[model samples]
Target chain A: MSDEKKLAIIATKGTLDWGYPPFILASTAAALGYETQVFFTFYGLQLVRKKLDLKVSPLGNPGMPMPMGMDKWFPVLGTALPGMESVMSSMMKKKMRDKGVASLQELRDLCFEAEVKMIACQMTVDLFDFNPADFVDGLEFGGAATFFEFAGESDICLFI
Target chain B: MAAFDQELDATGLNCPLPILRAKKTLSGMEAGQVLRIVATDPGSVKDFEAFSKQTGNELLESGEEAGKFVFLLKKA
Candidate 1:
């Protein structure tokens, strides 16, 4: 076998915050000359859709706790606030930018440039009634078996 | 005059970026050529170790200077 290792990522989360990890890791792995594949399934399909709408989950993400000062006072209300998802998403995006973290779009571009394979789950494609044309150019459409092939051979397998 | 066959300033870049860019740059170079790189990521010491090992490249020299991590690599 060729010495080039492989990385297979199962992307199941659909939120905007969740979107960053898969693309970031995929592109990074690809850049390192590792054969990289990202399998988008279930909610993760939104990431590959033609028109993407991503939002963060301030309601249940304990790791991304509520903003400073307010978390102490309105710990419960923070989760109940209206338009909280968008607010949290924008806030999180700003935080990432401040930390010099590349955006999801940038990471996707890097993945493409790095020759990382983007795979969409066929079951999800059928379930969502999305045509192959609905995704970014050059994406592969396949089922569990295809993903398993990559995952089985990968030195690093991740679920994002 | 170039001190090395190729030089890449990877300062301010973090893990994976340094190694990734290095890999890409090295791919374009002739085999047995040397590459000089500068980075600031503290984890680069270990990252470069794994990278060189996995890719079969030679880490000829590596050290820190002026707060920057310097590395010299010879492609396999």
Candidate 2:
């Protein structure tokens, strides 16, 4: 492996839980003094949105865990509940807070300060009707070729 | 012999932050420099462990004091 490394993170999910992985890894890589970039596509672009992407709640996923024990294991009952995703999302947020993990916003800010590159997928942006101005400052626009070109030189590539 | 002396006070900061700061600090140092970090976040222990593994930095000593965690790192 090269002593100096580059990393590319592909973000495709918009949920709070899903969002943490990419930010966490990307920030960590930047902290390690590696050249890092996070490419947001599809729903993942929500994170770059100035307001709509902040604090996403999993409101509709039924596979989320129940409040108490045992009920989580029941087969069909688990799938029938509403707001299960919200519960899971809250649980994840709580766990992170309790464990002293940085907030999503803090991680993002740290990444920017550390000069980690952030990119948005142009096709997804157009499809979602997202204005480039709606995203955080310093977001670049590109597609798969852009991502591949960046990833090809990196020692590590992660899709989250 | 002292390689180099650096201190990072990450008290009240969280997991990745401590490790993050440690990484940034180490990056500017030459091999064999020593870094001392004090943190209040509990997850820092595990975070540093993983950091040492991933970055090849050596954790010379780590322990708890006055409800705070302290780590001595040797850049490798």
Candidate 2 lDDT tens digits, A16-102: 767778888888887776899999999899877776434444345455444556345655555445775565667777877777778
Q: After aligning candidate 2 to the native by TM-score, how far in Å is the CA of B70 from where it should be?
A: 1.8
Off by over 4 Å in 1: A1-3, A50-53, A65-67
The superposed Cα distance between candidate 1 and the true structure at residue A47, in angstroms, equals 2.5
Model 1, B1-76: lDDT tens digits are: 2357899988766655687779889989999999999888788888887878777789898888888889988988
Residue lDDT tens for model 1, A35-133:
999999999988887677778876765666666855677676567688877777888888776654666776677788888998999998898787878
Candidate 1 RMSD to the correct structure? 2.8
Which lDDT value does model 2 have at A32? 70
What DockQ do the predictions score, one after another?
0.37, 0.55
What is the C-alpha lDDT profile of model 2 across B1-76, one tens digit per residue? 2334898989877757898888878888889889989999888888888788777888887789888998889999
Compared with the true structure, all predictions reach lDDT values of 0.82, 0.80
Best by lDDT: 1
